[model samples]
Target: MRVLVVEDELPLAKLIRQGLIADGLLCDVAIKGEDALWMADATPYDVVCLDVNLPGIDGFETCRRLRASGVATPILMLTARDAVEDRISGLDTGADDYLVKPFDFGELLARLRALTRRPAAAGGTEIVVGDLVLDPVTHRVTRGGTAIELSVKEVQILEVFMRRRGEVLSRLQILEGAWDNGYENRSNVVDVYIRLLREKIDRPFGVTTLKTVRGAGYRLDEA
Candidate 1:
C-alpha cells in the first residue's frame, strides 16, 4: 500500500516514513498542507496521514478541501491536541480516523490495515485467487489449505498481485506497490522477488499461477 504523510516536523516525518517503509509499505512525505493537496491529487495513495497543525492551511482545512475535491482516500489525522472538540473537528472535516501524538506505532499500523481491509466500498478482509488465500487483517497466507511463509516484502508484493489477479503488472508497478520512493533498488530486484514468490507459492504445489509475459511484465491468474 502507498501512503502520503503530511507532517511539518522534519524528524517526525522521517521517522514515520521509515517505520512505514519497514513494514513494506510505500510512503511519500509532504511537509506542507498545500503540497499534500497536490500530491494527493496526483498520486493514488491507499491512505493519507495528515498532521493537524500544518503551515498555512491546517490539516482540518486540508481534509475539507480534499473531500470537496472528491478525493476519497482514507485520511488518518495526527494531532497533539487531545481535546474532544479537536477530535470532533477532525472527524467533522472528513478524517476517517484520528491518532494523537506519541501514539504507539503498532496501533497506527493496525488502524491503517483496518482502513484498507474495510474501505468505504463494501469488501471483505481477505483476498482469494484460486486456491490461494490471503488475510489482510491476520497477515496470513495459505495455498490449498497449507500455510505459506513470506517476508514482509514478499507479502506486500503478493498482496498487489492478489488484488489485481489476471492483470499484467510491470516491474515499476510492482515496485511502487511494495517499496517506498526512498528505495534505490536495481531493476532486477523485482525479478528476484518474483522468482522467490514462485518458489513458495507455485513450485511446491505444482502450480503455474504466476506467469511472465515476455517483455511485458508478470501476471497472476487463477490456477
Candidate 2:
C-alpha cells in the first residue's frame, strides 16, 4: 500500500518512512502542510499519516482543506497532545483516525491497515443530493442555500434518505438506518420524523423532493 507521511519533524518522518518501507509499503514524506496537500491532490495514496503540528497550516486546517477539496483518502492524525478535546477536534476536522505521539510502530501499522480496509470516506463529510446538503461533521443541513434545523431523529432520517437518494426505502429499512436496537418499531415514528424533515427541508423550498412511494415506503428524489 502507498501512503503519504506528513510530518515536519525530520527524524520522526524518516523513521516512519523507513518502517513502512521495510514492511513493503511505499511512502512519500512531506515536511509542510502545503506540500502534503499538493502531494495528496496529485497522488491517490491509500492512506495519509498527518501530523497535527506542521510548518505552514498545521494538521487540523490541512485536514479541513483536504476534505473541502473532496479528497477522500483516509487520514490518520498524529499528535503529541492527548487531551480529549484535541482528539475531538481532530475527528471533527475530518481525520479518520488519531494516534497519539510516542506510539508503537505496530499500532500505527495496524491502524493504517484498518483504515485502508474500510471504504474511503464518502466525498468528505458533506453529503449532497441535488441542492440539499448535509454536513455530517457539523450537523448542519441546508437546502437551496437556506439553513434548516433538524432534530436528532430528523437528521438521522434525512441522512438515511440522502444516502439512498433515488432508492425506495421501506419503513423497516429506514428504522434500521435511523434508530438503534433499543428503538421498538411500534408506532408511526418514521412517518412523524419524515414529516418533520419535510417541513424543514422541502416545504419552504416549494419542492416535494421527499415522496411516499406507494406500496413501498418513502424515497427522496434529487432536485
Candidate 3:
C-alpha cells in the first residue's frame, strides 16, 4: 500500500520510510506539516503517519485540515506523550489510531493494516479469490491448498489485484498502488513484475487468472 509519513525528525522520518519500503509499502516522507498537506492533496495514500510534535501546525491541526479538505485517508497519529488528554485531542482532531513513541515496528504495521481495512470491513483480514487465498496479516499466500512463496513486492502487487478483482488496472494504476512517486512513469517495471508474478502464481497451476488487455491494461479474476 502507499503511505505518507509526516515527521519533523529527519532521522526518524528516513527510518520509517526505509522500514515501510522494506515491508513492500510505497512511502513518501514530508518533514513539515505544510508539505505533508500539499503532498496528501496531490497523491492518493492508503494511510498517513503523522507525528504529534511537528514544527508548525502540529499533527492535530494537520489532521483536522486533512479532514476539512475531505481527504478520507486514514490517519494514525504518532506521539511521544502518552497522556490521556493528548490521545483524546488526537482522536478529536480526526486521527483514526494512535501509537506511542519507540513502538514496535510490527505493531505499527499491524495498526496500519487495520486502518486500511476499515473501509472494507466486509472483506475481513484475509482475501480469497477462487482457489487463491491470501492472509494480509501474515503475508501468506496459498492456492489450492499449496503454499506459495512470493517476494514482498509481488505480494503487494497481488493484494492490489485481489482487492479489485475483475477490474482492469492500467500500468499507471498498478504503479500507483504498488509504488511510490519515486518510480519513473515511463519505466517498464510493472510489466516485468507482472511477468514474474505469473511465473509463480499462474504457470504452476496452469491457470490464466491474470489477463493482459491489449491497449488497455491488466485484470485479475478467478482462474
lDDT per residue (tens digit) for residues 1-223 in model 2:
5689999999998899989866646678899999988888987677999999998899999999999999999999999999999999999999999999899999999999889767736546678999999874456899888889876567767877887899999999887666543358876888888888888888898899999989899999987
TM-score of 3: 0.85
Predicted candidate 1 versus true structure: per-residue lDDT over 18-101, tens digit per residue: 998877777999999999999899888999999999999999999999999989999999999999999999999999999999
Q: Residue 109 in model 2: shift from native, Å?
A: 0.3
Candidate 2 matches the true fold with a TM-score of 0.54
For residues 1-223, what per-residue lDDT tens digits would candidate 3 score against the true structure?
7899999888998889999988778899998889889999999889999999999889999999999999999999999999999999999999999999999999999999889988878857789999999876677999998999998889989998998999999999998887786777866899999999999999999999999999999999998
lDDT of each: 0.91, 0.86, 0.91
Candidate 3 regions exceeding 4 Å error are 41-44, 104-106, 117-123, 184-186
After superposing candidate 2 on the true structure, give the runs of residues whose Cα lies further than 4 Å from its correct spot.
Answer: 120-223
Residue 30's lDDT within candidate 1 is: 96
Query: Using Cα atoms with residue i matched to residue i, what is each candidate's TM-score against the true structure?
Result: 0.91, 0.54, 0.85
